[model samples]
Target: MNGAPSTVWFDRKRIAPNVPEDLESIDPMCEEIGKVIQLEVDQGIPRNKIIVGGFSMGGCLALHVAYRFQQEIAGVFALSSFLNDNSKVYKDLASSDCRRPPLFQCHGKVDPLVLYEWGESTKDLLIKAGVMCQFHSYPRLYHEMNKDELDKLQAWIDQTLTSS
Candidate 1:
């Protein structure tokens, strides 16, 4: 500890051992999300009302599941994250029955772990595939969320939930 604030961390090595090559290792997480979604549906929640999102690795998984999920959901929120498997996402987007939920992806310009270019690439890719994605970049920000991001996220959640 270098006297910095403690933060939540995901074990990327264990989650995606091959990094840029083998993103399939995270597929199990998407399966778990499916189970949770099933449970939510069984409990009387409509699938379209469910919004999936997270930060960092969790955000990556959220994108993966939302893109590949058979049912259309409310939206996807990914913060300080990038697509785990660009090829897989492209393939999924090519499907005729693919879900095209609105996506809100926010990243920091100064993010050291996940470069800004990666996040931009993700937004561009999704847009090219005809997905509605709102991308926000914070100047001088790091690999974390700030008040502005939170405020925007809150507004997005409110609007999406009410409109849908």
Candidate 2:
């Protein structure tokens, strides 16, 4: 329901093999996503109604895309992800002329993979940079979404899409 009103889902068939050897090749994946989003806009989708968001690795990609092409998207919602090249990307975010979206970040306190600290750190950086961001931390849940998180996201999207 979160992606219902102006639901333009951006997806790619395969982004390499998700292996360490193929990690560097993921740039194509990012390009694919950018193409999809651009295709939608070229076809006449208004930029502000487009939201860039995803889960885990996709979440990270969403944030990167939002930062890189901020003027092209309306907002971003990231779940359990990280900004890997912190110095470069974070600095870009800080200095870029891109408009900060109404960003939402959700993470589990017990996330073992990316760790809760990653989310916390990103949240802090975003906040420090004056982004319109909302962060929610789930207690005891691991590196994934819980039902409550889904519900809140649903509500947030509903409110955002329906209102001016």
Instruction: Name the best candidate (by lDDT).
Output: 1
TM-score of 2: 0.77
Compared with the true structure, what per-residue lDDT tens digits does model 2 show for residues 1-164? 33345322333222222312222444555677788888888999877778878987778777767776554567889998666534234666678766777788899999887778877787787777767788899889897788899998888787766652
Query: Between which residue pairs do clashes occur in model 1?
Result: none
Against the true structure, candidate 1 reaches a TM-score of: 0.84
Q: List the global CA lDDT of all models.
A: 0.78, 0.70
For candidate 1, the lDDT comes to 0.78
Q: After superposition, how far is residue 43 of candidate 1 from its true place, in Å?
A: 0.9
Across 1-164, the per-residue lDDT of candidate 1 in tens digits comes to 34445443323432322255245456766788889988998999888888899998778778778888634789999998877443576677877566688899999999988887878887888898888988899999899999999899999988988988
